[model samples]
Target: MTSEAPLPKPSFMNALITFGLIVVVISYGLFFLKVNLHSLMLICLMIAGISASLLTRCDFSTIRHAMSEGVSRALGAIFVFILIGVLIAAFIQAGTVSALIYYGLQFLTPSMLLPAGLILCSLMSVATGTSWGTAGTAGVVLVGVGGAMNIPLPLVAGVVVSGACFGDKISPLSDTTILAAISSRTDLYDHIRSMMYTTGPAFLIVLLVFWLLGQQYAGNALPSSQLLLMSNALNNAYIINAWCLLPFLVMLGLSIARVAAEPAMLLSSVIAVLIAVFMQDAEIVNVLTALYSGGGPGQTGVAMLDELLGRGGIAAMMWTLSLGLMALSLGGILYKFGFLQVLITTALRRVTSVFNLVVVTILSVFAGNLTMGEAYLSITLGGQLFSDAYDERGVNRSVLSRSLEEGGTLTAPLIPWTTGGAFMSATLGVNVLDYAPWALLNWLNPLLGMLFAFFGIAIFKPQAAPSANHSTPTDVSFKSVN
Candidate 1:
C-alpha cells in the first residue's frame, strides 16, 4: 500500500494569511469587479495552489498529485451532476414538470403561494434527491407563476431554496447526504435519521414563517387569466397525464430501497425518455436533441412558458460541473499538502468540552465551505478533520455527520460563489444575497445544530465499553446537559 505523505506543520498565522488573501481577492473580484464566478474560482485555485507550494516547499508534481486525488474523490459527484442535467431535460420533454406546475397551480392561491411553494419544492427535492434539479424545474416554474401574481420574487426564491435544500440535506438520493455519510463512515440512513433531530424542527419553523408571510399577501388577487393561459399552453405543448409522474415515483421507490443514486437516476431518466417518446409523441430526434441542448425548442407560444420549459440538456450542467471540478481540484491541493489538516488541527486543539468541540466542528466545516465553495469537499474534509475528535470524545459518528451537513450542506447556497448558490441564482433569477435572508432553513439549520449541541438534546455518547472488533464504538447513550 502507498503510504500517506507527511503533512507540514506551518504556523497558523501563515495558513490564515494565505487563505485570507485568496478569499479577499475572490470576494473583491466577484462582488466589486463583477467578475464571473467560474473565473473567480479559477483565480482562487491558482492562488491556493501557489500558496500551498510556497508554504509547504512542495514540488509541482506533488501539488499536482494532490489536486488529482481531490478531483478523483469528487468523480462520483460530477457524474451525478451530469446525470441530473440529462434527467432534467428528460423531465421537461416527458411533460412531467409541466404537469406538476399545471396541477400545482390549481391548488395554490395567491395568498398561499409562499407556503405552498415551500411544500411543493420540498416534496419534489425529496423525491428526486436533487436540489439543483428541483430548482431548475419546479423552482423556475414557480418564479414565472409568482411573477404573474405580482408576488415578491426574492421571497419565492427563498422559499424554494429553503425547501429544496431541506430535502437535499436529508434525502437518501441526495449527493450531499451520500457524501456526508461516506465521508464520516456512517450508514446513509443513520446519518439522515440523526439530521432529522435538527432539520425537522428547522423545517417546521420555516413553514410557519412562510405561512405567516403568506397571510400578509392574503388579499392579493390571483392572476387567474395568466395562469389559465400558461395552463392552456402547457396542455397544448405536451401530453399532461398522471403517468408522467411514474418516473419520479420509480426513482423515489429505488431510493427508499437503498439503491445507489447513479443507477436510480439513470433508470429514472430512461423512463422519462420513454414517456416522452410514446406518451408525449416527441420525435426520437427531438428527444436526443433535448438530451444534448437541455430540452427541445419550446412549442408553447407564450414567452414565459418557452423560457421555463426550454431548459435541461447535458449542456446546461457544464457551468456547475466546471465550478465543481475547479473547487475540488483546489481542495485536493490543500488536502495533499496538509494545509487543510494543519488548519483544522490547530482549531481542534482548542476545544475542551463537547459543546466547544461541536461548535468548532461547525465552524471548521463552514470555513471549508467558504474556502472550497463546494458542499462535497466541505463535508468530506470536515469529517476527515473531526472524525478522530468525535471518537476521542466518545461521541457518535452520526453526530459528526449531522454537524457536517448542518455546516456544509446548509450553508453552501448562501455563498454567492459556491456551486449551490451560483446554480440557484442562475436557475431562479435571484441573487444569493437577495434570497438568503428568506432562506430561513439554510441559516437556521446551523444555529439549531449549535443549540442541540449546547443543550445536549441529541448529543450521543458511546456505550460504556468499546467494541473489540469495531474501530469506533457504535452503541450510543443519550446524555443530558447540565
Candidate 2:
C-alpha cells in the first residue's frame, strides 16, 4: 500500500478552538436550542471537517478518505445495533420479555421491591446485553409496579438504571462492551474478566444500599386485585413457561463460549421467532410485522400489557444508527486530520507515571461522552488516543478497555442529552436529572476504575517484550505543517 501525504500540523490553540466550537455548538444545540442530536452532530462534522481542511490547507479529498476509513471501523458496531433491535422485537413476540416481567413481578413485595427490581433488571440486561431493551421493557414494568406499591418512582428508576448499566458493562452481547474491546484491541473475554474486579464490588454495594432504602416501604404492598390483573394479562397474552426462557439461555451460553456476537444474537432471534409462532400461537404475518416494527397496540386488550410488550425491530434502531454514524464520522475526520493525535500527545507529555496515564484515559473518555453525546465515539476515540500511552507505560490493554467502559459506557446514562441518557429518560418516563443521583452504578463504576488504578489493584503489566499476540499500539506520528 502506498503511504498517503502527511497532514499539516495545526497549533494546539487552533486544535483547541476547533474542538471547543464543536462542543459549544453540540451543547447549545442539544440542551439550549432543543435541536435534534443527529442534526447537531452532523453540523459538528461539517464544521470540523471544513475547519481542518482550511487550517491545514489540505485537499478535501484527503479528509474525505479519512472520514470514510473511520466510519468503516465502526461498521461492526452499527450492524450489532440493528441486530439488537430485531432481537428485542422477536423476544417480545415470543413472550421472552413478558415472561421476565411476569416472574419478576411475582416476588416483588413493597419492602423488597427496590432490591428485587435492581437484581431482576440486572439479570435481564445481562441476558440480553442491551440496557435500552431492558429499560424499555422490564424497567417500564418495574416503574409501574413501584408506583402501585407507593415506592418512589425516581428511586425505582434509579435502581433500574443502575442495574441495566451494570449488566451492560459486563455482558459479552452488549454493544458498548464489544466496542470497548474492539477499540482497545484486547481479547473480548479478557476485557470482561478485568471489569469484574471493579464491577463486582460496585454491584454489591448498590445492592446493599438499595436493600437498606427498601426498608422504609416495608408496610406498603400492591393491591391484590392489581397484581392479579397484571399477572392474568401476561398469561393470557403469551405462553409463560420454562420454555420461553430458552432463547435467553441459549444466547448467554453462546456469549460465554465466545461465539461471535452477530451469530449468537441472530440464532437467538430465530429461536424466539419459532417460539412466537408455535408456543404463543401468534400469526406468522403478525409475528413478521412485529419483527420489523415492534409488537403492540393491545393484542390482549390491556393497555398496559400492549405498551409493555410493544417495542424493538430494525426500524427501532435507525435513530441510534444515525447518531452512531455521525459521531464516528466526526471522529474519523478529527483523527485523519491529526487533531486527535495532537490533543492526545499534548496530554501524554504531562503523564509521568502509570497512575497519571490511567487518570488521563478516564478523563479523556469521560470528556468524549460529554461532548460527543455517544458512547461508541467515546470508546473508539478514547481507545485510539490512549493505546500508545498504555503501551509506553507497560499497562495491559485490557485495563484500557475496562477504563473505557467505566468512563464512557457506564456514565452515558447520567448525561441528560446523551444518547443513552435520552433513551433511558424517554423509556422510563423519568428525567435524566431526576434519576441520575439514584443511578448509583452509573457513576460508581468509573470511580472504582480510577480507585483500582490508584492502588494498582488488578492492574496487569506487560512483559519485558510485547507479545506478538497482543494488539500493537496505534501510531500517532507528529509531522509539522509546511
The model with the greatest TM-score is 1
lDDT scores of the candidates, listed in order: 0.78, 0.77
Question: Model 1: how far is 411 from its true place, Å?
Answer: 1.1
In model 2, which runs have C-alpha deviations exceeding 4 angstroms? 120-161, 164-197, 216-220, 297-302, 352-355, 371-402, 413-436, 451-482
Q: Tell me model 2's lDDT, rounded to 2 decimals.
A: 0.77
Candidate 1, TM-score vs. the true structure?
0.86
- By lDDT, the best candidate is 1
Error of 2 at 56 (Å): 3.3
TM-score of each: 0.86, 0.80
lDDT per residue (tens digit) for residues 1-482 in model 1? 99976767567777787678878987898779988777887887888778887877878887788778877876766676777778778888888878777776777677788888899889977876778767766787688677656678899999999989988888766777777777887766667878999999999999999999988877775557877787888899888889988877776677556566678778988999999999988888989888878754366877766876777778887877777777778777766665656788988888898889888888888888787667777787888888899999889888999999898888888887666776787667688989999899999989999998999888876545434543331232111100
Worst 10 residues of 2 by lDDT: 473-482
Residue 52 lDDT, candidate 1, scale 0-100: 80
